[model samples]
Target chain A: MAQPNPHNTYLPGYKEVGHHEWRTAENSAPYLLPTLQSLAETNPSLTLLDVGAGSGTITTSLAKYIPQGHITAIDLSPDILSRAASHAASVNATNITFQPASVYELAQTFGPAAFDVVHAHQVLCHLDAPVQALAQMLAVVKPGGVVAVREIDMRVWSFHPFSETMRAWVEVQKATHAAAGGSNEAGPSLVAWAMRAGARREDVKASMGTWLYATEEERRVWGTSFRDRIVGGEMRKKALELGIATEAELDRMGEEWQRWMETEDACCGTLHGEILIRKPK
Target chain B: MAQPNPHNTYLPGYKEVGHHEWRTAENSAPYLLPTLQSLAETNPSLTLLDVGAGSGTITTSLAKYIPQGHITAIDLSPDILSRAASHAASVNATNITFQPASVYELAQTFGPAAFDVVHAHQVLCHLDAPVQALAQMLAVVKPGGVVAVREIDMRVWSFHPFSETMRAWVEVQKATHAAAGGSNEAGPSLVAWAMRAGARREDVKASMGTWLYATEEERRVWGTSFRDRIVGGEMRKKALELGIATEAELDRMGEEWQRWMETEDACCGTLHGEILIRKPK
Candidate 1:
């Protein structure tokens, strides 16, 4: 039997209800399309690895880009990994293989130089050892292959009809994430993290992306989901356990989200930092 | 003679030193390309208006998209307008016409339904009356034409190798801009402003864009230009005038930029909000 994965302490657990709906792979993976398409064209039979492949949503959607390519999706939680496998089967994504693994153990599981591309989205920021995780990811990619990662640069979130409660919610969220040893605003630090992982600066390409929520429908989807996460989900549980916020305060935040959703002129956006690190040939 | 354009109190005057090189037209206008290209295809002889056409850098570049079209570039400052005219001449952008004008006078100057598109970039945020200016822009556009605007949503800036002084710099910049009666963070509120200016919610389309400076060269260019603006250029003058920061503090902020440029692991990004509103046909 294997020892437990310590990084399982990732805030806002994915198994929490509504996590799948709030962050689907299809919605989140569009930003990575162009790069993945280019890679697929360059190597039709590419072997790609998706670390921290929560819900396997992005991994399965990525399958069509290279019909001839194979994707091995891994997550720390077997429960989520099994669900991801069932999802891939239901979606007819025949090219993907699901497995349970840790981000820190990529080299041991796949051996060195095993993959053509190693990718993780919104993953690194949650780890206490992101630099080491990146190093392990770099170790498993073939020379001349690439490792791509994207994480929310949560330092600034833009919202309209701004409310004090919402602002407090953002602060509390960041505080809790930090207390758990994750970097909430990890977007801009990607290049530095890659460089620290032993990749040369020249081989790293850094860019920015964004997620916008406006219109009544978009606001409702994001607002209500976020409210649920804050009030009754893993985030709430973590906040209470960590004493980051009192139960009354968490309840107020949930109400604030409701108010925000009801406002006629509501808009919110979060910026993301993305990087592509090519293994030196 | 023109009552000294009240909006000319715009913070960080353009005529101030180093302004032109810091924000050239070409670098600032790429975000509007797809929209311009699509409009060009729809109407080859597109009669477009570039409001606040500072330095004519973006205006001259926009000329190529609609070779058959004509552009009337307007600004409140005759001094900058002359420079813009000279720039257009040097670049052989024969289709562009530069003139001295104010955002509030657009309808009176161009007449109603005079152009196919009225576009502004980094323009509206500096006004005491952005909604009125937007309404004027709408008035001058043809019934089916579009009015497009992009503004820095200054609410959040993402930077790496974070520093307290640099953070203080951001706060002071916002404060000075606000003191001048400008909305420094006009990006996210664009839709609200448009609606207040009489645009229907359905007719407005909102999106987000970003400016990234990460590479050594990029960091140097942005950092140094910003330092110049903070220490000796328009920003410094405005900061002192508004009493937002002491001279010594402003000097330190400028030095901080220099230090940041020298730091190998430097990255910064700013988010902008963009909107396109179509006149109801």
Candidate 2:
């Protein structure tokens, strides 16, 4: 069992029902090559852990990739964890198990030297103590095992058919992250944070990956997901409470997303930082 | 013979020695997959044209990829063309030939339907008349063949260890492009430009690519290349003439590049837009 950290406040909160659709295991394809290679080198039956396993999209997807390997997918909210468990069941991902856990409790809950691989995607930026959380993660991974993390740098997000409303939307996102006391643009600092968490300089390797929305289908899917997250999700309430944007302003951004979807030649690209840290034997 | 367009002025001009090392065929790899597939489907002996082919790096590299195919590599400056020709010889690229030509002359110089494929890399954004040039490129490609173009969008370039001088460096680059009457951030509009250039809306496909410099070697190479471009290249004289930046400011930027090279965890990513338009049969 794990207890949630009282200090953590997540942005675009987990209550956003449709938010996870935008972050499927497919969205995480770029970060998986090295890990998949590692899995191949190791045994297929090795244990892996997924921290902050939102919606179980990536967790369930990983079940398919390593059918024989067992995965412990943990998150803080039982409500979200149950939902993710249901999703996993629906997808027939039997190799994955769920737990209500927080980043702060990972080492204690799982014990030391547990997982062969520890992976997190888009989770660190939302945590209040990412470096501390990383240290805990490092503790749970076996000596000589690897911990992989991927984070987005919204500062570099580029979108086509520029609109003032869209620009404000990006700013509001950054503000909301600040209001929640987390770093939204944490991609560039992953390597530095790993070092601060006690990983040696030589133990960390960094690379960049990208997310692009260009095709009509991709644009529509992304636009709808974001619009829903802002309009009907907890994000709308939080933003208004934080005074990041007015209700009417949020509504306008929602409308702008639909317009962006319809506009031909619309495109958006976001860069993500990937870090692989090896625990010394 | 092809004549240079009198109205055109290129930023970071061709006379910048060592500039071509940064843009080898490997740099253009992302844009080549579809084009390479097209080449494979077509006859191996089909003709290809490289407009604004700089340094003969991409041109000569392509020669090896398709040994039976022939490449006509064109640029505006005879001096640069001679250098590229010498480079091609040094590489022993037997299938490539260099020509001193401007984008404006492609149609008349090649005649209608002269080649199976036409490609341009980082060229359209610098041209005075990109749409006309694209239209000409379309006219020269065989019916059912493709015209591929790639342009950088500097507005979204992101770098780590942020400094005021580095920000100024990016702004000065945009300023120089503006002074030369070119669109520095032309990436997002690539699809629109292609449509305006006479391709039907449905005939064009757009994708985004990225350039990342993260490793120690990559940081040093990129930093050195830009420092040289700012210090000893034609760009320095042109920026001064255009009043884009003072000599002293440019020198400070050059020094900042050296500092950035030495800084650990330095990373930069630049996004580019790629377009492929198919001619109607």
DockQ of each: 0.72, 0.48
Task: Evaluate candidate 1 by giving its C-alpha RMSD to the native, one decimal.
Answer: 3.0
Residue B211 shift from truth in candidate 2, angstroms: 1.2
- Give lDDT tens digits, candidate 1, residues A10-100: 5556344343545554456555678778888888999999998878878888787878999999988788888888888898999998888
lDDT minimum window of 10 residues, candidate 1 chain A: A14-23
Cα lDDT tens digits, model 1, B154-207, are: 768898878899898998879877877888769888989999999999999888
Clashing pairs in 2: none
Q: What is the C-alpha lDDT of each candidate?
A: 0.82, 0.79
Compute fnat per model. 0.63, 0.37
- Cα lDDT tens digits, model 2, B1-281, are 45456455445564555646556666665566557656756688978899988777888877777788889999877777788889889989989888887778787887999988898998888877788888889989999888888888877766777788888888877877767778765887788788888898678877766777777887888888888878866667777887878999999989988888887767777778888888999
Best by DockQ: 1
Docking quality band of candidate 1, CAPRI definitions: medium
TM-scores of the models, in the order given:
0.92, 0.88
TM-score of only chain B in every candidate structure? 0.91, 0.91
The TM-score of predicted model 1 comes to 0.92
